[model samples]
Target: MENKYEDYKNEIKEGKRTLNQTRKELGLPPINGGNTEFINREIAFCRKIQERR
Candidate 1:
């Protein structure tokens, strides 16, 4: 059962579902902001995720 759920979880994570969902939960704007400031903010967010480990 756990394995099956993990498979489903991994499938969604592969599509950036978790990241996008979290962003939505925080009420943040869409990831594709289409500007230099937004790109920098996205990079910062990626770095924050990397640092979590």
Candidate 2:
């Protein structure tokens, strides 16, 4: 079976989904306007995923 993380990453790469959307699909809480720290962390995680490509 394909990894869900890989699947989500590919969906993002293909412009089929945004990070926030993927997070919601993964059951993560949405990052709100005041959640700068969570937003930055998610951004950093995305950067790392991109680096792996």
TM-score per candidate, in order? 0.36, 0.54
Clash count list over all predictions: 0, 0
Kindly list the per-residue Cα lDDT of model 2 for residues 1-53, writing each as its tens digit: 88989999999999999988988988887767898898789889999999999
Q: For residue 7, give model 1's deviation from the true position in Å.
A: 22
Instruction: Tally clashes: model 1.
Output: 0
Residues 1-53, candidate 1: write the lDDT tens digits: 47744665685778846655655665766566555698687789999999998
Question: Per-residue error at 48 for model 2, in Å?
Answer: 18
TM-score, cand. 2 vs. native: 0.54
